[model samples]
Target: MRVFQLGLLSALALASVPAQADHHQEASSQQAEHLDAGRWVTLGTRAGPVTSATRSQPANLLVAGDQNILVDVGDGTAGQLAHLGIQTAGIDAVFISHLHWDHTGGLAAILGLRAQTNAPPRLKIYGPPGTAELVSGLLASMVPGATAGYGVPGAPRADIQQMTEVVELRDNASVELAGMTVTVRNNTHYSFAADSDLARRFESLSFRFDLPGRSIVYTGDTGPSAAVEDLAKGADLLVAEMMDVDDTIAMVRRNNPNMPPQVAAGMERHLREHHLLPKDVGELAARAKVGAVVVTHFAGREVGDPAHLEYLREIATNYDGPVVIADDLDVF
Candidate 1:
C-alpha cells in the first residue's frame, strides 16, 4: 500500500517525458551522436565467472529512450551503466523481472548512489512483494537510516515517501505512467517462495511495457507459461530467454539419475513448459501477433558462434516476423 505524494501528477509528469523512443531514427544518425561512446553496447553476457561452465554472469538490459528505465540489473551492471554515460542514481525506475542473483546482483549501486547523493528521492523501485524487504535489508546492511543523508549538491532527488512500490502485477494489472500503460502478468516457473517462514520462490518478476506506439515484453524468467502470450498480447518486441535444448537435458540427466526411462520422453515437453523454446517463440509471436521476438539469456551451447546461431535461427520457422538474438546493448 505504499503511496507517492505526487501520484496525482504522476501521469502528467510522465506524459511530459518522451513516450516514443527513437525507434524510427536512422542508425547512422544515432551512431554519430554516440560515436564517442558506443551507440548500442554489450555490458555483460559472458557465460560465467569461473572456468566451469555453470559459473556465468546474470542477464540485464537498459533502455534510455524517452525516460530511462532499466529492464534488469545483473553483475557488471555498475560498470555497464558507467560506460553508457549514465549515473547509477539517475535511473528513474528499475523493472526487475525476478530476484535471481544474475538478474539483480548489481543493485548495490542503487543504494550506493543514494548514499553518495545525500539520500535523494526514495527510489521508487517496482517489483514483487519481497522487493521492498530486499531493498530495505540491503540498505540497512550498508548503512543505517542512510536516508538521513538528505541533502547534497547535484544529488538525486529522493522520495522516501514511496520507498518501494512492490506491485503484485497480475494479468491486465497496469499502472499509468508517462502516457503509457505497463501491463504485468504472472510467469510461473520452478522458482517459488521457499517453505521457510520466509517465502523461497518469491524472487522473480516479468513485464510487458507498453510505451506509446511501441510495446515491449520482458519475460523475466519462465519456462513456457501461457501467461506470456497474454501479457505480450500486442507488444512490438518480446524479449525472452533461451536455454540450450541439449545442454539443459544433459544437465538434468547429470543431476537426476533416478529418472524413469520414460522421463527421457518428457524433455521436449518440459522444455516448452519451463522456458521459451526457439521454435515455440515463433509460434508465440504469430499467435500473439507481437511485432517482433528477441531471444537472449543464452546458454553457452545455444550462443556458440555461427553454428549454434544457425540452430537458433531454425526456431524462427514457427513465426513470421523480425527476430533478434540479443547481445548486451542491442537497443530496441
Candidate 2:
C-alpha cells in the first residue's frame, strides 16, 4: 500500500476561510499519483489521540469500490480528502463511527468542498444516533458557492454512492452496504454527546464490513465490550482503538495533581466502559477468529519509545492473524 502526505491546516481554518481553497486543491493534487491505489484509499489516515489533536495525520478516510464511503472524517479531513484526490460531492456516503469533533471535524469541510464542486450529485451521511443532526448542521453551515456547480445536494449524493436504499438498523444492530452488509451495532463506548447527565450508561458504536473477499471491523473509539466480538467474528480486518491497558492503569495510579481528578475519573470511566487496551483488543480479534487486524484511534500517553510498540506487539500476540499498527494514511 502507498501513503501520501498532506499540507498542514486546521479543519476550521480550512473550511471557515476561503483563501486556502486553491491551496487545498493544488496541494492535494500533487499527491494524486501516490493516492491512485488499486481499490482503497485512506483520504485521511491518522491515529488520533482525541478530537482535533492530530499533529501527524488527517482523520478522514475513503473506501472506494462498488461503493464510495468516507469514514470518520476529522479536522483536516477536507484538505486530506483533497490531498487524496477524491471529490467530496462524488462521495456516496459518510459513516461516522462516533460523535467526536476530531473524527467528524472535516465534515463541514467536505460539505464546503461539495459546495465548491457543485457536481451532479449530493452526499449522504450515516452515523450512529445523532448523525442526522450533525450532518444537517454541517450542511447548513457551508458557504454557498462551495459546491454549487460540482453536484447536487444531500439526498442525491446517496444515489451515486450505491446507498440509494435506506436500511435502518436496530440500536445495536448491523447492516450492509453496496451489495454487502457488514455488521453495525452499538457498543459500550459512551460520551457526553450520547448522554447529557453522564450518569446513566450511554451508547456508542462499531461497524463490521463483511465483503466478499474481506471482512473488516471499525471499533469506533470503544472500551472493552463483548458486543465488539459479536460483530468482529471472523473479520479480515479489525480497525480498533489502541489505548494501552497498562498505560491506562498507570495514569490512574499516577494521579498527578495537574490532572483534574474529575476529568481523570471521567476518562477512567470512559476507558473502562468504552475503550479497549491493546492486549484486550488483540484477544478480541483472536477470539473473533479474524484473519487480519488493523488497529487505530490511538489516544494515550506518547508511545514514541519502543516500549509502547513492544506493548502493542505483545498484546497482538494473542491474535494469530496479521496485525498492523494503523497510522495516518496507511492503507491496510
Candidate 3:
C-alpha cells in the first residue's frame, strides 16, 4: 500500500502550502450582503472521505425560522453541529445525497448523540432507495454504544430502531418536511457505475428546498446534470460542488508517477465525467439563472487565493451573478 500512503502524503503536502491558508477564511464577514434569514451554513466543505485540516467532510445546515434541515451528513457532521451551537435535538430532518462514506459516515454519530442527549424519539432521515438498508446497517453497528449508554445515569434508553425514521426516495420524488417542499432529482454521481451491481441498488440525489420566500438547491456531489439544472432553475442559492481539473491531474501524477497509463486514464475519465469542473459549474449556474452560487464540496487540491481567483474568473465567464467560495462554518 505504498502507493496509497504516498497519495495521502502528496495530498497533505500539497494542501499544506501556505497559499491555501486563506481558503478557510475567504468569505470571512466581508460579504454579509447575501446573508439573510433562511440561513445556509456550510458545516464541512471537503470532498470525499479524506478529511482536510482546513475543512471537515461534506455537511451543510439550513436554518429557517424554527426548522433546521441538515443536508448530507458527512463525517463529523454532529461535531460541526455542536461546534456551531446547534442543538442535536434541534435537527428537524436529514437529507442524504448518497450512500458514500463521506456523505453518510456521521449519520450514526448524529443519531447516537441525539439519542444519548434524549433530544427526540426519532430522527427523520430521507435519502435514495438504499437509504433504509444503509441506516439499518448504521444502527446495527452502533448497538454496542447504545447498549453501553443504557447503564449510564440519565442516558437515553431507546433502541436504534425506535430512534430513526429512514424515508427512501426515488428520482423526481417530492416531500414536505419542516415546512419546506423538498424535491429530489437524480444526478450523474452514480451514472458512471451504470454497469455495476451498486448501480441497481442505490442512487444519488440533488435536493431543492422551497422554503418561504427563498429557494436553495444543494447539488450533492454531482457532475453537470440537466435534471439538477431544471431543479435549481432560478433558485436564490445554488450550493454546488466544484472540482479543479488541473489540480486533480497534477495531484494524481505527483502521487502515482509509476501508475499505469490505463489506470491513470481511467481515473481522469471518472473525474471529468463524475465531477463538475470549475467552468462547468459556472455554466450550470448561468444556465439555471441562479441568483448566487456557493462553491463547495471541493474535489481537488486545496483552494488557495490564486487558484480561487482563477476558478472565480472561469466561473464569471458564464455566471454573472454572485459567486462565493465557501469555507467551513461560512453562512449565507
Among the numbered candidates, top TM-score falls to: 3
Report the Cα lDDT for residue 185, model 2.
75
Candidate 2 minimal-lDDT segment of 10 residues: 8-17
- For 42-113, candidate 3 gives per-residue lDDT tens digits of 888888634577888999888755678899988889878876667678898889998888888888788877
lDDT of 2 at 309: 71
Q: Which is better, 2 or 3, measured by TM-score?
A: 3
Stretches of candidate 3 off by over 4 Å are 1-37, 150-156, 192-198, 252-266, 300-304
**Candidate 2 on 16-88: residue-level lDDT in tens?**
1122345456555433332222123444444443332444333535353445677677777666555545566
* lDDT tens readout by residue for model 1, 1-332: 01111211122211111122343344445433422211122244432212234322544443434445666667767666664566666666667666656666777766676556654455556776566666767666665344454545554544544444444443446776545567677676443444754344363456776654456677766776677778777766677776666666666667778878787667546554666656666776777877666666665453446757664576667776666565554444
Query: Candidate 2: deviation at residue 182, Å?
Result: 3.2
The worst-scoring run of ten residues by lDDT in candidate 1 lies at 1-10
**Alpha-carbon shift of residue 209 in model 1 (angstroms):** 1.1
Q: Residue 283 of candidate 1: its Cα lDDT?
A: 72
The candidate, 2 or 3, that scores higher on lDDT is 3
All candidates: CA RMSD in angstroms? 9.9, 9.9, 9.6
lDDT, candidate 3, at 310 = 83
lDDT of 3 at 256: 76
TM-score each candidate. Answer: 0.68, 0.70, 0.82
lDDT of 1 at 194: 49
